[model samples]
Each structure stands twice: as structure tokens, then as C-alpha cells.
Target: MNGNTERQFATNVYYDRTFDCDAAKILPGEFYYTGQDMLIVTVLGSCVAACIRDRVTGLGGMNHFMLPDGGDPASPVSASMRYGTFAMEVLINELLKAGARRENLEAKVFGGGAVLRGFTAMNVGERNAAFVMNYLKTEQIRVVAEDLNDIYPRKVYFFPRTGKVLVKKLMQTQNDTVAKRELDYASRLKVEPVAGEIDLF
Candidate 1:
């Protein structure tokens, strides 16, 4: 709870009758966490989302991130882990502030697709997926579920309180929108770091 006592929510969402709770949609380079029962959603291409929760307290969060280009292998490893580290830490810290314990956190990860069709030689999808998994492992967080690496775009819906995640893989014809968004996001990272201050939970 920052200065704004009001809870932040997603806007312009079309209600889906399939789920009973209200939905909060997250876009590229954004993340959200809460103790409420509302659903958190996001569409993904090459970017990865780590859905983490404290099983006991039911406090959870999800972060969407793409690793920036690793220039100069000679640079310190910390420089390369910058964006990924920030994404992971923000989500985890928010959950902790909401009463989650570090030892009780479990994770579910999704989205790392090769949908861009060789746009970058570095294979960003693979790197993003690998980076998140390694980061979680290094932090001793157990990943309970994962849907990583493939050629399809996916829509993810996460229920923070219950730790339920529904993933729908889209057909090739329907992937254009997500691919373009993710590609644009990846391109933006090269020129500038993520804009704005990290949201205080």
C-alpha cells in the first residue's frame, strides 16, 4: 500500500464470463501483485513472466521481463543480469511487503516463444527463459509449474490467491499482434532502460 490507499487495477478490459473474478491485465514490462482474489492476465511472446506466491499467506505476484542485450562479455556479470534482476526483485519484494515469507514462495513461469522468427541472432526467447529459471534457482525458489520455449504465443491468466494459472497457446495466424508487441518491447530495451520508478506495493 503506497500513498494511494486505493488498489490499482487494469482498465479497458472486456469481462470474460469464464472466470468469476475481475481481471487485471498486465502489459509488456509491467508487473502486478496483490492479496486480492481478482485475476491477473498478460499475453506473451518471447518475454517471460514469473508468477510467484507464498503458499501459506496467499500473497503473490507476476513480472514480465526481457533481458537486455549482453554487450561485451568482458563486462561484469551483474551488468548482464540488470533487467532480469530488477523484475524478479520487485515482484518478490512486493509480495513480502504484502505479508509473504521468502521461504514459502513458489513459482510458476510462462512465455518464452520463438515467435519472432529469427529477428535477432542472440535467440532472446531462449535467453529470457533460461535467465529467469536460473535466477529463481539461485534464489532457492521452487518453480512449481512452467510453460517455456516453443513457437506459439500464449495468453496467461493467474490467480494470485489460489496460485492457479491458465495458459492458452494461440495459433500462428493469431500471433501477429503479440509478436509485434514483444518485438517492439525488445527493441526499446536497446535504446533505453525501463521507464518510470518501480511501483511500490
Candidate 2:
């Protein structure tokens, strides 16, 4: 297994009293998938999450990520694009490995909020929103739902087994933590090397 694959799987598993089920919380640059009935959750600010599932088999997962700024936009194989591709591929490959058929995959996307200061000028949230949609389209995954490019941070709850997603848009006043987390994540992306390549099966 690649170091990126091992590091990107969300490890914070716990039980959620509100939903009364097992849950995994994924942060920026992380993802989670399961064949069992469980919830995968994340908070987003200037980031995006893709929830993908096999409608027939109910095997699914979610990935949270942001493309770092400053890559050559004209090049399709730029560093930022590579990072985003890895993020999506890791989740999809895991699902396929667990028996999800490629033809059965569908997607619901969320987040891409302009909650971070100084990022609005470059429209980081909009860039992330566009990248995810385009990536799914290129991979031929049908997107059944989406909520993107808003000014408020969002908390996303994904039940992969049921292909159900609940999104709560946070008021700007409630976004301090979300903003801080994403800012720190973006900082890390600038200095840290992007994860190694992941090929879709």
C-alpha cells in the first residue's frame, strides 16, 4: 500500500448518539469508505467533498480535499490537479476494490464555501467546486446532487450505504473553526509534496 493511501483513510471512528450509528470523521485531505452501514462526516470551508456510491450494492465512500493554489492552470497535469485526482481516485478505487461496479457509481457533492479570509479574491472555493464537478464528468460518474459556491461553511453528513447526504450550512459567525482548519490545511499543501499517483481501476 502506498503511504498516501494509508495516511488518507480517516481513522477517527466513533459512535454517534444523534444518529445512533457508527461514524467516521474525515478532515481535509482525508477520505472514508465502508461496506457496512455507517456515517462519514466532515466540515468544509473553501474545500469540497464528494460522496460516491454504488446504487445497486450500497458500497460507498466520501472524500474531502482542496486543490492547492499556484499550479499552472493551462496544464492538465499540474501539481494541483494531480493532488485533486489522487483524492478522488483513492476513494473510488477503494469502492471498486470492495466490489462496487464502475457502471453503478453515482455522486453527490457538497461544500466549496467562501469562509476563508483572503481566499475570496482568488475564488478558491469556486475553483474547488469546478474541479470536482469536472473531474467526475471526465471519469463518467453521474452527479445526482450538489450544493456548491456559497459564502457559508457547511457540515456534511454522508451515509454511504444508503447514498443519503445531509448538509447544514453554517452561519458566518459559526465558521471560525472551519476557517482555521482549512487555512491550516491549505498551508500544509503548499509545503508538503502531493500524494503519489493513484490509478483508477
Backbone clashes per model, in order?
Answer: 1, 0
The per-model lDDT (C-alpha) reads 0.78, 0.87
TM for every model, in the order presented, reads 0.85, 0.94
Put down candidate 1 lDDT per residue, 1-201, tens digits, no spaces. 131111123353445578977777877777888788878899988889999999998888787877766654233354445677677877887788879998999999999898887766767788779888888998899999999989888899999899999999999999989988887766666666432335433
Estimate, for each residue in 166-201, the C-alpha lDDT of model 2 and write its tens digit: 999889998888988888888778777766667788
The Cα error of candidate 1 at residue 99, in Å, is 1.1
Give stretches of model 2 more than 4 Å off: 1-7
lDDT of 1 at 153: 83
Worst 10 residues of 2 by lDDT: 1-10
Winning candidate number (TM-score) = 2
Root-mean-square deviation of each candidate, in angstroms?
Answer: 4.8, 2.1
